[model samples]
Structures are given as C-alpha cells and as structure tokens.
Target: MIKDFNEVIKSRRSVRFFLGKNIKTSIVKECIKNATLAPNSSNLQLWEFYHVINDEIKINISKSCFDQPAAKTANQFVVIVTRKDLWKNRRDFNLNFIMNKFKDLKDKKSRRKKKNAVNYYKFLIPTLYGNFLKISGLIKYLNVSILGLFRPMYRQVTSSDLRVVVHKSAALAAQNFMLSMRASGYDTCPMEGFDSVRVKKLLNLPGSAEINMIIGCGLRSEKGIYSEQFRVPFEEVYFEK
Candidate 1:
C-alpha cells in the first residue's frame, strides 16, 4: 500500500483516459465522506458532491463538458458544487449542534460559548449572506474596507467575494476527495471545462448553486497520463516575508 502521503499526492494526476473496469461504489462513497472532513469557512460546509453512477447521466454530463476525453472516458463523475445560498440552512444546523453541545454542560463558560455561537449564526451569518440587487454586499464591502483602514477587519464582503470563498472551500473538499482516491489506488481528473448551466439543470440543483469543478474518476488506462508534471522554479512562486 502507498502509505506515504507525499507519494500519494505526487502520484495523483489528471488522467485523460480510463480502463473499462468499474470501481466499487462503497469505496468512492467512503472517499467522499473523507471530503466532508476538509476545513471550511465558519464550519458552514457550503459544498455538495453529486456522484454520477448512472450510465446515461455520466454520458450526458460528458457531452456537457464538450465530450473531452477526460470526461468522455470517465467511469464516474464527482461534481463539486458550491451552495452559498444555503448559508441560512447550514447556519441553523450549526446553531442546533451548538445548542445540543451546551445542553450537557453546566457552567457559565459553556453558556457564554453557546451565546456567542448562537449570536454568530443568528445575526452575523444572515448579515453576511443576505443581499438585494447586490447592493447590500456592495455596502458591506465598502464598510469593511473602511473599517480595515483602522483595524483588522474581515474584508471579503461582496457577493462575488463570497462566491469565491464558497468555491475555495468546495475546491478544498475536492482535493481531499482526490487525495483519498489516490491513496486508494484510484485515478481522478479535475476538469473546469463544462457547461455550468446545463450541468446545474442536469443535476437538478438550484440556480443559486455554483459548479466548483467536475472530477472524473476511474482506473487509469495504459496511456492515461498525458504528460510529466511540471512546475515553475520555487523562487518564482514562493516568498518568505
């Protein structure tokens, strides 16, 4: 078994071709469960994974991706989606978890903890997520930018900024899923080339939900790996301050 995490990470590649053999559903699902453990903003976990197992659906999705070899030849697909509009639902879930957590404790500190947690979900999340014609996010962005001048402030406030934030967290989850698959001796290819609108409709997801990336999963074929890995020199991209 490839026990070394570094080796697993290094071995993972965007395989464009896959073998005819199929992978077990249970194994893929377990890797998806690992994806949920990825760190996310405010513990909201505004991400959803759609595992496409149906023959017709995968083919449809492949076409939506322009019938690229990566998607066309994939045995299955793991579609990562960002659900920023579900913030209220996730916030309430977090509030419930926090409430249940403090119920067993009998201390003033615990009460304070519950109060802060409740306030964050009840007040702060709505303020950050609620928007009208993008004006509210605009105002919030300006306010944060001004506040940041005097002190450290959370400046990511606009709707576009929040979109990026949710997508980033979803991408992190996708990475976790990919790494877990690599460790399990499976291959995956993360592809951004796709018809987002058609994909959303195909998946029956809400319009508010955004497609983060579509990952192709299967066993690599004889010539699946298209090229050797390449990277810029460390000095060009890395800096210590």
Candidate 2:
C-alpha cells in the first residue's frame, strides 16, 4: 500500500547508507513519470532524468560525487538535468498541442484565447529564450530595466536568468521524484556535492545542458539516517503578511 502523504514527507531523509537490497526499476520509472507532471515554467518541461542502473556507470558517477556515503552505497542514481537549450522544441510542442485542442472551437472567446496562446509560444518565447552570443540577452535585460521604471515588467530576461528558471523547474521535478520514491518505500538523497564536469562527461551530456542534482536511491540501511531530523523552529520562518 502507498504511504500517506504526510507519512511520506516525514519519513524522507537524506539516507547516507543503503541496504544491499534491490529496488524495482519499474517503480523508479513510474516515479520519474510522475515527476514529468510537475509544474514548469510555461509548460516547457526543460528537464531530463537519467536513471543510471548500470553498475559501471554508477561507479563513475559515485567517483564524480567524491564517493560520499550516499553515493558509495546507493543502489542506483538519478541525475536531473536542465535543458535550457531545448526551449524552442518545447515551445513548438505547446503550440501544436494548444492549436490542436482549440482547432474545433470556432467561438469568439475560443479564437481569442487561441490567438493569445499562439502569440505566447511563437513570439514571446522566442523573444525571451532566443539569444545570440549573450549580446541579445544583454539588450533584452536593458530593455526590461528601462520598461520597469514606467510599468511592471518581467526583469529576468537574460540568459543567466533563464538558466535559473529552468533549474528551479527541474528542482521541483526532483522533489516530486524523491517524494514518490518515499511513498514507494524507497529512499533518496539529493546531492549537489559532485564534480559536475566529470559527471557531465560520464553522462555524455552537451555543454549547454546543466546538472540540477544527482539523487542516490535505495532502501535505507538500519543506520542510514545519522541523526534525528532537525529544523529551525517553524515560527522563525513563518510570516503573516
């Protein structure tokens, strides 16, 4: 039976040591499918999950992670990647999907909505995501900065800003994957302490692609969790505005 949502959240920990027991690959794949349903900026879905099951590849990835306990003992690894370079393809996909959905609707409101959606994918996406040698990004950033003085304007127009946008979306997917694993009686550790260059090379990823995180997955050992979970008091972080 699947665990309750609260139980899953409370049970999840950064498991540092894993039992030699194996986890079902199919379940992991299901969790990845759930991850794809995570909300992303403009539905671009600029993320990729590399589920490393091969022992040899996992070893190399563990080396890239400096053989941290989580990496060293993990039964498998899931690498989350951010693909800002694929924005154009994703935009086209959204456009095709939306156009097809509204194609049969001839009402004025439907036509207006379709037109807005088309403009968003065709014009706005290119304006924000299209960049030439960083020059265009700079120009767009400057344009937004000036426009903001007169009215509300989206200022995250540069390439770097867009990179952050994609990474945030990918991170959300990562969280979904981890929680889903917990719900399935598996554990995960999201690790950023890795030699990204080596990890990318091992994965044969392109230069434009970025590693959002590497997650170690397995059934936890008895001593997996090193200590009791701790958090800053909720009162300190919570705010009422």
Candidate 3:
C-alpha cells in the first residue's frame, strides 16, 4: 500500500549507468507479477518478457540497439516481444471497442460501402491475374487488384482481436513493473530504439513474436543526470462536461 503515487512518478528515471550491482531475482519476479495485473484490450495479454542477464547477451542487445551505451550499462534488460500471429486479435478488439462506444453508428452503410469499394479496387484485381499481366510496371497494380477483392473474404472469416487486447495488456504490465520498481527504490527506462530483426535473431524468436519495447532496470549511477520533462496541463489533456 504505497499512498504517494506522485513520489513514485517523480523518482522514476531512466537510469543509464550502473554499478555492476544485480537486482535480486525475487524482486524482479515480484515486479513482473505486479505488471501482469495491468488491464488489456480483452485481457489477452499478448506479450512475452525476456530477461537478459548474461554479459554476452547484454552486449549483443546493446549492439542490436545501435550500440547505445545505456543498453550494455544497465544491470539487466527486459525485452518485450509481442506475437504477430495475435495482431489480428488486437484489430478485432479495437473494432469491437469502437462498436461498443458508438453503438448507433449512423454512417455504417457508408463506411461499409467505402470499405468494400477500397477492397475491390485495392486488393482483388491484381491477385487473380497479376502473373499473367505482361506489363512489367503494372505488376504491382495487378497484385493490388487481387488483394482488393480478397480482403472482404478474409475480413469476414477472421476470428478474435487478441493482438490489440494483448499488446495493451502487455504495455500496462510493463508500466506496472516500472512503477513498482520506482516505489521499491529503483530506476527504469523503457526503450523502443532497437533493431528488431537483430533482436529477434539474437533471441532465436519464432516468426510469431514481434519486438515491442525494451525496459532496463537497475540502480542509478552517481554521475547519471536527468532533466525534468514537461507534460501538458490536465485541463488540456482531459475533457469533461
């Protein structure tokens, strides 16, 4: 029961340097467990966390991140990977959420008509006979024609919005981990700056998993400096009747 949420928020900083001190495994586990409690689109939780602790593994991650000094300097790195196969689930979740919010969609017919037209013109035509087209420059056009037609067929049969739901859930979990770390007297950094392909290869990940973001956790170095960033006032960021 930490009461002062602002204290945690103020204390949380991107700690780039470390003192070779390791955060206990139990602490990490607890933090992760707290993160899993974060809400998601449909509670799909479509994310996996990889903890990199070995020196060589850390070095490789740093290299994949364009050789940023922070990557290698942190005590540990938590690599966040989302599943690509589950992205359709996310899309479905988003669609459903939209429907829920606007149950009386006055322009449903128009929207569907536009969607259908785009599908036909963009995806269906070229797919069916693109290879037969001899016009070298029009090959892409032919492919688009086929895709336009097939989009409707694919869209109708798709199942679940697991990706959107899961990624949102995963991000919530990540945020919890960061907040918990700060509350427990630790510093954390969320990083989206990395070569995803290289990271996937390094982790030997399956094609289904997509790299989302990396979070590093550790004690801050004495020399590390940070500036207070600004945020839009609450009145500007929120709306109420």
Candidate 4:
C-alpha cells in the first residue's frame, strides 16, 4: 500500500489540459473522502468543497476565475471554500476523530469515565477552552493573522501566512485527490492564479466562506501542452531529522 501510494505521488503532475471525458461520481466521492481525511488546524474541519459538474456553472466559474482555459476544459472541477465562522470557532473535522480515538482508549476503563470524557469534549466549556489554548498558536497564525484585512493573500508566504496555512491544508487535500485521480487513470491541475472575491460572488459564497483554489480534473488530451520545468533537488529542498 505504501509503495502504491508513493508511486501515485511520484507520477502525479498538474495536467492543465484535458480530454472530454466524464468522471464517475464514485471517483469524486472517494477523492473527497480522502481530502476530508487531510490534516487541519486544531482538527477543525473548516473546509467546504464544491464539486461543479454543470457545464453552465462551470463556464460561469471559469470566467470568474479570469477565464482560465483549463478551468473550462476540465470534465469537472472542484472549488474549496473555507468557512469563516468555523475558523473563528476553530472547529475542524479532525478533532472529532482525535477526541473519539482518545475516548476509545478511555472507554476500556469504566462507562462513567468514558461518558465523562465524551461529555467534557462534546459539551464542557473548559475542555474546549483548554483545547483552544493548546492549539492557540495555530489559531493565532491561521486565523487572527495574515490576509490584509483587505484582500486574500496569494503567492509565496508574504503577508497572508494564515491563509497560506489554510491553502497548504487545502493543497494537501487537492494533491491527495490528484494522486488518487492519477492512480485511477485520470488527470488534474491545481491552479493558483484566480480572483478570490470574484469567485466567491460567482459561487454565491457566504460572507465567511473564502475561495482558495480550483482543481481541474479529467483525461489528458493529445493536444495538451506541458512545459518543461525543473524541480529542486532533494538536497536543496529538505533536511534530515
């Protein structure tokens, strides 16, 4: 399983151009499940993903994203939206898994302790407060900071460090989806350049929801154009533990 996953990771690439091939809903669902399994700040599952299959809606979104040809060409596209309310509360989906894992370990003891632990996390204010303090750094950096209180920050790090954290999480999810797609004989592109506000408006997003990036998925076409870009060597990009 590890070898297969590594192979998928190594073979996956950004496929900007695609063939007119429809992806099965099952595949999309599987990819989304994998994406939701991605790590998040405080186990807070702040992300909301939209799978756009309608041609008209896709066309409108494509225009909103500056008419990127790849956006329109994909058989299907996925938009990642981050909920502001959820971010403010610091509630991510992973937290539930974590709490449950701990609860299971505790359940081996007594029913009373198991119930107490679950209630403490599920309702107790102090437990939540403690959890908040533990992951406070993540909150301060991922929410309270970055993004000029004015616009969404993109590019390398820069001012939107918080947004970058969310983007990194979303990007990891997207990469996981892409690798799964590749393993299933599909293609994908992780696009960064886009107008976030315009995209939000086009998608009728909530005030708290932020549009991060779009992923184009489909089959590669014979006419697809791929640029020859060099990736940094391991020595230049990593350090031993």
The predictions' CA RMSDs to the true structure, in order, are: 1.4, 0.9, 10.3, 8.1
User: Cα RMSD for candidate 2?
Assistant: 0.9
lDDT of 2 by residue, 1-241 (tens): 4998999999999999999988999999999999998999999999999999999999999999999999999999999999999999999999999988899987999899999999999999999998866599888988999989999998899889999999999999999999999999999999999999999999999999999999999999969899999999999999999
lDDT of 3: 0.68
Using all chains and alpha carbons, the TM-scores for the candidates as numbered come to 0.95, 0.98, 0.64, 0.69
| TM-score attained by model 4 | 0.69
- What TM-score would you give candidate 3 relative to the actual structure? 0.64
**Whole-model Cα lDDT per candidate?**
0.92, 0.94, 0.68, 0.68
Model 4, residue 213: C-alpha shift (Å): 1.2
Residues 26-123 of candidate 3: C-alpha lDDT, one tens digit per residue: 67767877876777643445677888877898888988877665676677888877764554454456455555665555698866855664454344
Question: What would the per-residue lDDT of candidate 4 be over residues 54-93, giving only the tens digit for each residue?
Answer: 8888888778667676776888888877663465255434
lDDT of 1 by residue, 17-91 (tens): 999889878899999999999999999999999999999999999999999998999999999999998998899
Q: Where's the lowest-lDDT run of ten residues in candidate 4? A: 153-162
Best candidate, lDDT: 2
Instruction: Give the Å error, residue 20, model 3.
Output: 3.3
- Higher-lDDT candidate among 1 and 2? 2
Q: In candidate 1, which residue ranges exceed 4 Å CA deviation?
A: 132-134
Worst lDDT run of 10 residues, candidate 2, spans 130-139
Displacement of residue 53 (Cα, Å) in model 2 is 0.3
